[model samples]
Target: MTFSSSYLFSLTTFIYMGAAALYLIHWIFRVKKVGFLATVVTVGGIVIQTVGIGLRWIESYQLGYGHAPLSNLYESLVFFSWVTIVVYLIIEWQVKQRVIGAFATPFASLSMAYASFSPNIEDKIQPLIPALKSNWLIAHVVTCFLGYASFAVACGLGIMYLIKNRFSGASEGIMGVIPDCKILDELIHQTIVFGFLWLTLGIITGAIWANDAWGTYWSWDPKETWSLITWFVYATALHARFVRGWAGRRIAYISIIGFASVMFTYFGVNFLLSGLHSYGAQ
Candidate 1:
């Protein structure tokens, strides 16, 4: 086993926790330096996580497994955390919003912590099952997790909206630090749109992969079925916002609900339901 990857990931989890704390401090105290510290720590964590993923990929090659570091549950969760932070950082940079980090970073930290601490998860590098030994594996997994990461960010924004709307009539105090409700609403819409596109690609790639392995394009497996369900949820959200003039609390609630569908597609399908995608549970 390559210890480096595990070590880096463990460090990443704690660093994320620290970053989250810093973000909250910045929000509560209105301290500019603390917010910058949070941003620096999160960016540093992302850099370390990139290195860790690379090391894990190399170790898989050395073990002769010869696949991306995405064959099982542990690595997927790690990648989900990684990309969530990446997307969040880009948003933070462009929008100049640090309070979102207070909501977003904990999801990244929690993903890593669960992957590291959960007894049901294993961190070993293993050869792919015969069905997964295809080029589509990487494409499907990466796109799906990118989509998942965006949904995670959107969900965090949803929480922020709820909190901001529930209080702060004048947009003062902690609410003053957060972006405006209208801005959060726009961000939530945009994030879900980004996620929707990638998720479409992920599902298409999975269909192609299934065809190559099983001679069928759509099997209606629990995973595939639920993925379609999640897709429709986001599609409806987008439609409602653009066509139906939905905004604010309604969009925020739907974003949170959409993420719940995402979580079920990613996690529930593996443990609570079973099908060809059961390999992920390993």
Candidate 2:
């Protein structure tokens, strides 16, 4: 079979699935070896997916589009998967915890699965809309999705936090694999801070792109509005952490809510609302 981008992405989806399972097994049955294998599988999957993305970019130029492979919903979803794993691996490296993969890899897997299987999403490389022809396209999309991917990992950490927090008393069995609640809390804050900076940059770059494309920096389009809302969500969480000394479940809840806003801004605004950015859905 031809090694098309779609085929590689499909393979990546299953690789992530297997990685997630290995992580779960590691967490549940205390299979230390499986945790290492899971990390290895995830690393291999991302390498293959990276090659696929580069191949797609080459294919685009070959087809005369001559643009980055980040032009539509399918491409964005694939990049989202890529960036999420990148961020997760970083966290794993820093914190020395592989159990988070059980929660994190699923997000990447689901994204790849959705991109590969969703009938509504087209995987073809199409011409850029005139508005998207700006050089800012790469900067804006990369920053925004980096922020999105970071939040995706943060959301997974939040879920892990909640699980460990809820089962504080049952710390002997499967729950033992998760880090301490305090560790998870601190990681949640650090992840959000990292993502917030990127999101802030994303919004700034987006506003500049808007000015170039639409003669205004802020149009309050549905996508733009929701992006601001998502920014504020993380901002509020950070503010609470810094000024109010909040932590634990409150921060975890906010992380989950913030990611919800991210999703709505990404998928909901594209599909549900008509706006200048509606071409994103295409």
TM-score of each: 0.97, 0.97
Which stretches of candidate 2 lie above 4 Å from their native place? 243-245
Q: Give the Cα lDDT of each candidate.
A: 0.91, 0.91
lDDT of 1 by residue, 91-152 (tens): 99989999999999989999999999999898888888888889998999999999999999
Cα RMSD of predicted structure 1: 1.4
Ten residues in sequence with the least summed lDDT for candidate 2: 239-248
Off by over 4 Å in 1: 1-3, 243-245
Cα deviation at 169, candidate 1, in Å, is 0.8
State residue 54's C-alpha deviation in candidate 1, in Å.
Answer: 0.3
Q: What's the distance in Å from true for residue 209, model 1?
A: 0.8
